[model samples]
Target: MAVTKRVVLHFPRRLVEQPVIYRLVKDYNLEFNILRASITAEPEEEGLLVLQLKGEQEEYDRGVKFLLKSGLKIQSLSQDVTRNEARCTSCGACVTLCPPGAFVVDPKTRQVNFDDEKCVACGLCIKACPPRAMEVHF
Candidate 1:
């Protein structure tokens, strides 16, 4: 069976410039989709990448092991972002700032819908929301 997972990866300063992501595809037979990344040429700070990985369960596990061995911190995507419907006004303010289109306005009800699966936890929506509805955990 195939498995897909979304995870936040933290790269140590020393490993920030490595070709590990390429290895995940070529060596592990895993597909990598980088949703968001913060990397710099300097090795002064740890870099972060939010990625979606897809492959067989075994291959995914192996790839995760490889990441762990390389001193990368892995975090699950669950609880990364949330929306309070009671506090939301469907103002569509967050729709423009969300890079992944996680927030959408329902055509029929004209209400805003929050899709957690599509959220990359970039935290831009939280500030864009006028009612302060979007909350980011990480």
Candidate 2:
């Protein structure tokens, strides 16, 4: 039987919207539905982003593993702030480097706003960061 379960992915403030998540979905052939996702905290630059998801058991387990291997910090819905606020200096490295366009720079404020819905939680930004600002919330 295909058992379905509710899962919430608490993405770190950084690298929330990247290609790693999509890759996991496609690679595992998992059926997923996003329940809720947002920056749900203050100082968007240094806050926690929440991603609520529902999917099959096997697929979901694989998805969780995939996310872990990809370097994303995962947290159940019950646990909040699994990771810490990112101290990115808006270096613009992740902006162009992110394939899914997860990192965007505000030319006006030069602050980076990580969109969790768009993020796949790939660690490219984490590796690319010179200041080591991006944190993975697992």
Q: Which candidate is the best by lDDT?
A: 1
Please provide, for model 1 over 1-138, each residue's C-alpha lDDT reduced to its tens digit, 9 standing for 90 to 100. 799898988888888769989999998999888877888776677898889999999989999999999999998875677888789989898888888888889999988898888887878988888899878764
Cα RMSD, each candidate: 2.8, 13.7
lDDT, candidates in the order shown: 0.86, 0.59
* TM-score of every candidate relative to the true structure: 0.77, 0.42
**Residues 28-133, candidate 2, lDDT per residue (tens digit)?**
6655655445554443543233444445667778888877775666665433212234566666777888766877778899877666445555556777778877
lDDT of model 2, residue 122: 50
Clashing residue pairs, candidate 2? 16-119, 17-118, 17-119, 18-119, 18-120, 21-120, 73-137, 73-138, 74-138
